[model samples]
Target chain A: MNSLSLSIIGFGNVGRGVAEVLYTKMPHFKKKYGINIKVVSITDTSATIWDQEAINLREAIETKNHFGSLKFWGNEYEVYKLDPMEVVKEIDADVIIDVTNDKNASKWHLEALKRGKGVVTSNKPPVVFDYKELVDLANSKNLPYLFEATVMAGTPIINLLKEEILADSVKRISGVFNGTTTFILTSIETGMTFKEALKQAQTAGIAERDPSNDLKGIDAAYKATILHHLAFYPIDFKEVHIEGIENLSEEEIREAKKEGTPFRLVATVEEGKVEIKPKKVYENGPLAVSGTSNVAVIETDLLGELMLKGSGAGIKETASGVVGDIIRAAVSIYKYL
Target chain B: MNSLSLSIIGFGNVGRGVAEVLYTKMPHFKKKYGINIKVVSITDTSATIWDQEAINLREAIETKNHFGSLKFWGNEYEVYKLDPMEVVKEIDADVIIDVTNDKNASKWHLEALKRGKGVVTSNKPPVVFDYKELVDLANSKNLPYLFEATVMAGTPIINLLKEEILADSVKRISGVFNGTTTFILTSIETGMTFKEALKQAQTAGIAERDPSNDLKGIDAAYKATILHHLAFYPIDFKEVHIEGIENLSEEEIREAKKEGTPFRLVATVEEGKVEIKPKKVYENGPLAVSGTSNVAVIETDLLGELMLKGSGAGIKETASGVVGDIIRAAVSIYKYL
Candidate 1:
C-alpha cells in the first residue's frame, strides 16, 4: 500500500513529461496520498525498458533524451522489442498509463483493465468508443479507469465532474475544447488571414504537419462525446453534429470580431446530444477565455454555473492531469487492497 | 454500508438547503456512491428534532417554511427543547454537518471529531482558527473532516486543489473570496459611490445586516487562511494582513476603473503568508471575474495557473459543496468499515 507500480504505454513527449513530473513530485504524492508511484515498465512503439523492480524514471527519461529512444538506449537484450500489447499484458503493474496519443492504444487500455489493473489514459479512442464498457469493467473490478486528459488536457473537466457526480446532475456543458483550433481562430481575429493563421500556428507548433483533425472538428467532437457520456448519457461518436472551423471566411471572422463576438470552436454537450461548431462566443461570459486557454461551463441543477479554465494543451500541463489520475488510481488500489 | 446516518446541527437556510439537496439527490447519491444518507437528527439553535430512523428532510423543510421554526411543527414529545451541544453529544449519527455560522459551533466541531464522527461543515471558525488541530485529530482517527464550503461555498476551490495536490506544488493561490465585497466593488465600478454600492448590495440581499465582517476583509482573510493551510502550510488567523474596502474612496475606485484594472478585494495565499486587500485585478486574467462570482487562480508548478470560478453565495450552491463532502465522508466510512 505504500507504493504502487505503473507501466507507461508510451515513451513520447507526454510520457517523458509524466516521468519528469513524478520524479519532481514523488515526495508530494507520498505525503498527500500516502502512496508512491513507480514506473515498472516504459514503452515506445517498437521497444520497451522493463524492470520488475521499478525503473528509475529519471534515468529512463535521460536515456530516451540522450539516445533518441529507449529502443537505442539499451543493448538489444536489455531493450526488448515488445509492443504495447505485450507490455500491457505481461507487465506486473497496478496501473497502465496510456499516453500513446493515438487510436491504436485503445485495445491496450481494455487489455489492462481485463487483467485487473487500473488504467489512466490520455488517449481518447478508448473513452470515445467504449465509454460505458470500459467504465463498467473497471467498476466491476473495483478499479479506476480515468481519462482526464482526453478532453481538456489538465484543465480538469473530467475530474471536476467526478466530484460533481453525487452532488448534482449536469444540465449542459459547453466549452472551447481544442487548443489548436482556438489558437488558429484567435490568430485570425488578430487580422491574420486563415492561411496566414494556419501557417503561424504550424510554425508555433500549435498545429500539426497534417492539421485536418483539428480543422475538421474531429478532435473537438471526440472530446464532446467523452463529456456527453460523463455528464449526461453515453453517445455515439457519429451522433455528434460537427461543423469545423475550416469553412470560416476571413470576412465573416472580421465581421464577428467587429461585433465583439469573436468566433470560437464551441463544443456543447446536452442531455442526448453533442455538437461541435465554430460560433461567436459570449462577449463576457465563461466561454470568452482568450489565448489557448480552455474553458468549460458546467450548468448543474444545484450549483447554477461553474467555470473551469486552464491551459488545454502542453506536455507538462497534460502530465499534471495524467499524474493526478495516477495518484487517484494508486490511492484506489491502496484503499481497496 | 448502504446507509449513512447524519446529525445536521444547524437548521438555518444553508442547513435547510443541505437537507433539500440531499432529499432531491437521494436517488442520485444512492445510485452513484452506493450509499443512502439519512438524517438521524436535526437541530436548530433552540430546539432539536430527533429521529432514529431516517427523517423526511422535505417534510422538515416544509415545516420550517410553513411555520417560523421547527419549534411549533412537532408535538412536545417529538421536538425536545434541546440546544446544539445536547444534540451533538447524544445524537446517533455517522457524520455531523455543522452549518451554524458562528464561533460557538467551533467547540461542537472538536467534540464531534472527538466522538469519532466525521464532520462536513460550512462553518468557518473551526477552519480559520483551529485548522491543524481539527484536521490532525480527524486524520489521527482515519476520519474525514472536510470544510469545502468554508472558503468559497461550493465553488470547488478546495476540492479542485485536493485533486491537484499530488500533481503539482502550489506556488500561490489568489482569488476573489468574498462575494459581498465583489458585488460592492463591481457596483462601484459602474460609477456608483461606495455608500450607494453598499446599499445596492444590501437591497439585493448580498450583504448582511452588520456587513463589517465582509467590509473589514475579515471573511476574505479567513478564507485566505484556509487556502494557505490547504495549499502551502498551516497559518495563524492573525498572520494574514487585512485591509477593508470600507475606506475606499469613490475617486480612487473610478481612477482604477478608468485605468482598466478594476478594484477587487483579492485574497492571496502564498508560502508562509496570507494576505487580503482591495487591489486591482488583472484586466484579462483569471481574476477578471465580475459580479459575485468567486474565482481562484492556483499557480501550480506543473500546470501553470488553474482557475476555478463559481457563485460564491447562495443556499443551493453551498449545499452542493457540503453534500459533496457528505458523500465523500460516507464513501470513506463505508470503505474503512
Candidate 2:
C-alpha cells in the first residue's frame, strides 16, 4: 500500500468537512488507487494537534465540532501552541491541506511547497497573491498545488482549464463567480433590501459572518485573478478592476427585472483584463445562475462557448473539491513514485 | 525531452482535424509539456500509409483532402494492405489515434489496448458495444484508453467525470448529447418539418450523409451509454431505451412551444437505467440546449447539481478533445517513464 501522510491547517467547516470525507472514503480511495491516506495533524487558528500515528478522524471531527478544538478529543494527541507555518514544518506529512480562510495561510502554502509537500487548498489568498511564485515553486519541486475549490467549489473549473481546454485559447470568461453575492442579488430581485438579503444569506449559512469581502467583490476578484492566471496569464489580484454589489438598490434590481433582465455579479476576464461587477444578464443566458449557484461561461476559439454551473460554496461541496485535489495529487504522486 | 510516436486510424474529417491541430500546435505542446509528438502512420478505410520517419502532416492532410489517399502525397511511405488490427500489431508507436466512424475500429481498439498502446479515439462504437472488454484490457495493462471526443466533442465531459467529480456519487446524468439532433429539433421549432430541418442540418454541415443513427437516437444513446459507464456503472449500449426524433411532426413542436417547453433529445441515466428520448424541457433547464449546443446536468450527492454546456460536435471541437486526450496520455506516460 502506498500510504501518504496528510495535515490539514484549519478546523473550520471546510476543514472538518474534508476530514469527514477522507474518513468515510478512505477505503474507497485505497481500493481505487492503492493509496492509503492518514491524517496526522490538524491546525486551527487557536490550537494545533500533531500525532505521528494516525489521528482518529471521527473523534477529531466530533471534538472539533462540539468543543471548537481537537485538543478535547481524549488525549491521544499533542497540542502545540504554534503558528500554522511552524506546525506545517513540524509535521512530517507528504501533503498539506490548507482550508484556512486567512492571509497567513499564504506563507504556509509557500512553505509547504518549498518543503516538497503537495498542497490542496480551498483558500484563495495564496493563489491570488502569489500565483506565479507559488505555482513556480510547486512546478520547480514537481509538487502539486491544487485549489479546485477556490473558484467554484467542486464544479471543476480549474481542472477544465488545465486539462481539457489546453488546445483552445479562451477569449472571454463571464459568470457569477460569487455565490453569496448571487444569493443576495437574487433575494434583492424579490423586493428585499440589500441589508435584508445579506442577512438572509447569512442566516441561510451561505454568506460568511464577515461577508464584506464577498459584498465588496474581493472574493470574486480573487477568483477571477486565479482564473486569469490558469486560463490566460499571471495577474495580481489588485490588478483586477472590481465593483461590488454592496451599493445596489432593490429598485435598481426591480427595474432590471421589469426590463426582462436580472442583475448578476458577473466576473469577466476578456483580452487579459479582469472585472467583477454587477451587470444585467439575459434571463436564459448561462450567467443567470439562481440562488447560491455559481456559473462560468468561457468563450474559446476552437470549442466555442463552454459553461459550467454548480454549487459554489458549502461545506460538502468545498470539501469535495479539496478531496478531489488530494486524490489528484495522490494519483500524480503514484505515477511519479 | 520526452517524445512519443503517434499512429492515426481513419483519415476522415476528425482525423484530419486532429492532424491539423497537431501540426499547428506542436510548438505549444512541446513548450508546455516538453512533449515532442510525431505522426508516424495514418490509415484510412481504403489505404494505410506507414512512414518510419515523421510524415509531413500538412502535406498529408492536403493529399488526403484532394486525392482521398496519403499515397498521392509521396512514394517514400510504405503502403499496407493489411487490416487495422494487423497494422496495430505492426506499428511501433506509443499511442493509436482512432477517428474512424465505424464498428470495425472496435476490434482495432481492443487490439491496440492489448498490445499496450494507449488508444485515444473519437469513435463511439468501440466504447458503446465493447466498453467492458476494452476498458478492462486497458486497465489491466495500465494503459490509457481515452475517448473524450466520443461524447460532447471537446467540451471536457469525460475529464470532468473522471478527474473532478471523483468524490461525489453521481445519481443522475441528463444531457443534450447530440448536436445534430439538437440543431434539427430547434429548426423544427422554427416551423420546419423534421425532413426539412435534417436537410438544413446537412447543408449546414451538422448532419452526416447517413444520419440514421442520430435521427434514430442511436448516437445519443451511445453517448449516454458512455456517460453511464464513466459516471455510474457499466451497462451495454443495448440496455439504453432509445426513442429518436425521426417521427416528430411540426405540430408536436408547435404544441410544445405553446406549452412553454422545447423538445430536446435528452439522454438520461438514473439508478442504473438509461433513456434517450425526445422530451419536453423547461426553457432554462440544463437539457434545453439549442442550436448545435450540448449540455449535461449531473446530480451528485455531495456537490448538489452540476451543469456543463458547450459545443457538442464539430471538427475543431472534436479535434480539441482528441488532442486533449493525447496530451493527457502523454503526461501520464511521462510520469511512468
Candidate 3:
C-alpha cells in the first residue's frame, strides 16, 4: 500500500496541534490501520519546504519550535519562499490541510479539490459562503472536502447532522454555536458590562483581539450557513434573523432568569430559513441547559430533536476535529486504492 | 431529472414512519432540492402491492388505517401475496426499504444490491452481522445500502462517525449506545429493582419483550462494531470487554448516586480495541450529563473529545435519520449524474 503524503498549509495553533497529534499517533495509526502518513510539505506565509521522500515529523516540529520557521531546517529538501497558491499546487501531496487563520484560504481548498487533492479545513468562510460550489466540486472529483473543525470545533455537528441525524427535514437548529460569544454573554449575565465581558473573554483566551465577529454573531452565522448547506437544505443567511448579545442589557438577563429562563446565543435553521440570535430559553429547553458549554439543538421532523454539546473551541478540541478529518481522509484514500 | 422510485419492504412501525415522513415532506424536498421521491410499492408478510405509476401516499395511509394493510387499498395498484425474495426482484424500485423484523434479511439486502438496486433499511441484523459484505456489495454496485435508522434511531451516530468525525485515529469511542438498556439502568438508579426496572422499560416501550440483546449489552456491542467498521478502523466484538446492567444491584446504584455518580452502560472503542460495559460516571463526566438520553463520547487523538446526545430511538427519530440518508444519497447521485 502506498503511504499517504500530506501537506500542512498553515502553521497556526491548529496546524501545529494537528502536527502534534499526527506525530504522537503515527506509530499507532501505522500499526493498526496499516498506513504510513508522512508530512511531505509545510507552507506558511513566510516559507515553504518540500521533502517528497517524507520529512521527519519530529525534526520538523523541533525546527519549527527552535527557529520558528522551516528556513533553518535546511536539509537536502527543496525549500522555496513562494506564495500560498503556488505551494498548494506544487506540493506533491495527496492531502492538503488548510488550517490558515485567513478565512479566504477556504477558496484555496476548492482549488486543491479541483487539482484532485483531498481538502480538510478548519477554515469556515468559503464553506459558509460557497458551500454548494465546493461540495459540487469535491463530488465531481470524487474527493473528500471536509470541514469538521468549522463548527463547534471537536464536536461532531457537521457529521452528526449530515450522516447520523439524516433528518427528514430540520424543523429548527438552535443552540450556542459560538463559544467566545457564549462566554462573553454568560459573563454579562453575571453583572459585567459588554466591554468588561469582552475583556474577561480575552483574558480567558476565548475571545480574539478583534471581537467583532463573535459579538455580531457573524461567526455563528457562518457555522449555521455551512451546516445548512451540508444538510443539503438551502438556507439564505440574509433572511436569517440575528440578535447578538451586544444589545442585551443586564436588566433583561436578570428578568429572564427571574422568569426561570436563561438567555443563550442561538443559531437556528429551519424550513429553508436560518436565524442566529440571542433568545430566552425556558428551564426545560436544551439551550437553557447548554450554559457556557457550547451546544447545538438540531430539531428535525423525523428525529424529533437532538443536541450535541462540548467545548466548542480550544487547541485540543479544534486539533481533535482536524485529526479526525485527517484520519477520515487517510482511510478514504486507503479504501479507494 | 428522474424521480426516485421506492418500495417499502415491510409495513411495520419504521416502514410506516418512513412513508409518513416522505409523504409529508415530499413537497418541501421537491420544491427545495428539485428531487421527486415517490413510493411505488409496498410489501409485508401478508401481501405485496405495486404500481408502475405513483402510489397515493395519502390514500395508502388512509387504507392502512382502515384495513390495517396497504394490500387492501383496492384496484388502483397491483397487489399480490409473494415471498420477500420475490418481491425484492419484482418491485422495480430504485431503492428497497427493508423494515422487516427479520434479522436474517442480510441475504435479501445483498440480493437487492446484486440486482443493482439500492437499499435503505431499519433492520439491524444484516448490517450488524455482515456489514463488510453488505458494504462491499453496495460498493460494487455503486448503490447506497443505508441503515441510518438501525441503531440510534435518527441520531446519525453511524454517519457522524463515518463521514464527519473522521479522526486521524479514533483513540476511544464510549457511549450509552443502547436506549432500552439505558432506560432500564436509569429506572434502576431511580430506586426500581432490576426486574421492576426491566418491566417499566418494557411498559414504556423502551425495551423489547426479549430484551436480552439490550440488557446483555449485545445491542450496544453491535452498534460499536458498526461504528468502528464505518470509521474504517478494525474492531472485533469478541476482543471487546463486555459487561451489562444485568449484574448490578439496587444498592450499588444507590451508593453511586450518593457519591454524585451515575451508572451508565457505555460501549468504548479505543486504539483498535473495544469495550462495552456498565460504568460509574462522576457528575462532571460526559456520561453523567447524558441522563436518559442516548449519548456517545467520541475521543480521538486529534479532535479531542465530543459528545452526541438525543432521542436514541423511536420511529420519528429513526425515520428522520433514514430521510437524511435519502437526501444525502440524492445529493450524491445528483453530483454523480
Candidate 4:
C-alpha cells in the first residue's frame, strides 16, 4: 500500500486539529480509503520540525499544546528556524497542508504547487486573493489545491460547487458567510448592545483578539470573492463591494423587525458583482441564518435554488474538511488501476 | 483529451431532459471540464437506436418530444427490437445511464457493470434493491456507479455524504425524501381531503400515473433504505419500517395541526433502523420541507448537524443531477496523470 506524506504549516488550532484527526482516523483512512497518511514535517512561526521518517505526531501535538511551540521536541528530530517558503522548497512530502493565517502564505502555496505537491489548506488568503494564479498553477501542474475549510468550514460548499454541481450554471449565490458577524448580529437582535455582543463573541472564542477582518466585512468579502471565483466569475477580493455591521443602528434593526424583516450580514455574488452587507431579510428566508451558523443559497438554472446550512467554525469541523480534502487528493492521485 | 461515451436506457421525460442538458451544456463541459461527452446509444421500450459515431442529441430530444419515438430516423442509426440487457451487452460505450422505471433494470445494471462500464442512474430500483451488488461490482472493476438523482434529484446529497463529508462520522440522517408525497401532504394541509390532495398532485404532474409508490410510502422507504446504506448501515428495503399517509385520517391531520405540529412524511434513519412515517413535525423544524422540496438533515459527529435543501424532483433538476454524476465519473477517469 502506498502512503501519502504530509507536511503541515502553522501548528495552530486548525493544524493541531488536523494532526489529531489524522492520528485518530489513521486506521479508518487506511482500512476504508486504502491510503496511509504520515506527517513527515510540521512547521510553525518559531520552529520547523522535519524528519525523513514519520514524526512522532502524538508527542508533537502534546508539545505544541503544552509548550506553545515545537521547541520541546527531543534531539532525534531535526528542528530548524525556517520560513514557510524554505520548508516548502526543502520538505520531501507529497502534500503541503497550509493552516497558517499568514497573509503571505499564498507565495508558499504557489511554490509548493510549482514543486508538484498537492496543497490542502484552511487558510483563506491564497484562495480569496490569489485564486486565479494558484488555480492556474495547480491546473497547469495537474495537482489538487483544495481549500474546503476556507469558506463555511466543513460545510463542503466548494466541493459542492466544483464536483457535485459541475453541469449546472450557478446564477447567483447569497448567504451568511461570516459566523462571528452573524453571532454578534443575532445577539444584538436579542436586545444586547453591539459592544456587549462583540465582547460576548470574543469571550466565546468565536472572534479573535485582532478581529478587524471579521468585524469589518473583510472576512465576508474574502469568502464572497472566493465563492464568486469558484461559482461565477473570478472577481478579485478588492473589487468586491463590502459593508460591515458597524454602521447598522439599533433603531434600524428595530424598524426592520417591526416591518417583518430581520437584519443579517449577507455575502452576495451575482452577475459579475460581489458584496457583503448588513441587509434586512425575511424571517423565514434561506439567508436568515441565526447564531453562529452559516448558510449558502445557490441559484442555478438546472437545480433551481439550493441551500446548504451547517456550523461555520469549529476545530473539529475545519479539520474534518481539511482531512476530507486530503483523502480526496489522495484518491485523485491513486484513482486509476 | 479522451471523449467519454454514454448509452442512455430511457427516452421519457428525464431522458429527454438529459439530452437537452447535454446538447446545451456541451460547450460548457468541453471548455470548463476539458472533456467531450457523446450520447452513443439511446434505447426506449419500443426501440433501440445505437450509433457508433454518436447520435444527434438535439434531434433525438426533438424526436422524443414530437413523435414520441426514434422511428423518425430513416436508417441513419442501428435500430433493434431488443431487451435492455441485450442493449447493455451490445452497446459499445463507456457509461450506461439508467433512467427507466423498469423494475427489472437492476439486471441490466448488473450486466453493464460486469461488462466494465460506468453506470449513472436516476432510476431508483437498481439502487434501492441491489445497491450492494451494483456498488460492489463497480468497485471491484474500479468503475463509477453514481446515483445522485435517486435520492434528492439535483440536491447533491449523495456526493455531499460520500465525497465531501467522508472524514466525518454521520450519526443519523432524517429527511423528506419523496417529493410527491411531500407535495400531497402539503396539499392535504391546505384544506384538502386525502383523495383531493392526491388528485391535485396527479393533476399538477407531481404524482405519477400510478402513484402507489408515492402514496404507500414505498418511495420514501426506498430512499431511506438508500440513505441508510450510504450514511450508516446497509439496511435492506424490506427491513425498513414504513407507515404511509393513506392510513392517516383527515381528522388526525386537523388534530395534529391544532396541537401545533404539521403532518410530514419524514424518512428517518438512525441507529440501524430506517423508517418513513407520517410524523407531526414542528412548524419550522429542519424536516418541515413544504411542497415538492426535499431536505436532508445529516447529523455528523465532526461537523455537528448539516442541512441541505433543494428541489427534489423535476425533469431538468433530476437530469442535472444525472449529468453532474456523469461529469464526475468522467473526471474521475481523467483525474490521474
The per-model DockQ list reads 0.65, 0.75, 0.48, 0.79
lDDT per residue as tens, model 2, A1-337: 7678898988889998999999998887887767888888888877777787888899888888899776675764577786788877887999999998888677888888888799999989888888898888998999999999998998889888887776787889888889888888888888888889888988998888999999899999999889999887798666789999978878998899778788888999986699988999998777888877998999987898898999888889999899989988888887666
Error of 1 at A242 (Å): 1.1
Candidate 3 per-residue lDDT, tens place, A1-337, comes to: 6799888888767878888878887777677667878888888667877788887777777778888887787566667886678867877789888888786776678778888999889998777777778888898888988888889887777766655543455667777788777676667667887788789889888888999888888888888887777664555667667767778887887678778787777787766777888888875655764433677887766666677777688777788788877877888788777
Candidate 4 CAPRI-style tier = medium
Ranking by DockQ: 4, 2, 1, 3
DockQ of 4: 0.79
Ranking by lDDT: 4, 2, 1, 3
- Give the clash count for each candidate: 0, 0, 13, 0
lDDT tens per residue, model 1, B196-255: 888898898889888999999999888888888888778888778999898888888878
**Which scores greater on TM-score, model 1 or model 4?**
1
For candidate 2, write residues B1-337 as lDDT tens digits.
7578899988888999999999998998898878888888888877778776787899889889889876675665667775577779997889999898878678888888878899999999888888888888998998999999999999999888887777788889888898888888788887888889889999998899899999999999989999998876788666789999888888998789778898989889886799999999998677778777898999997898999988888899999999989988888888677
lDDT of 2 at A2: 64
Model 4: fnat (fraction of native contacts): 0.84
- Would candidate 3 be rated incorrect, acceptable, medium or high by CAPRI criteria? acceptable
Stretches of candidate 1 exceeding 4 Å from the true structure = A75-77
Query: Could you tell me how far off, in angstroms, the CA of residue A73 lies in candidate 4 after the best superposition?
Result: 3.5
TM-score against native, each model = 0.96, 0.95, 0.79, 0.95
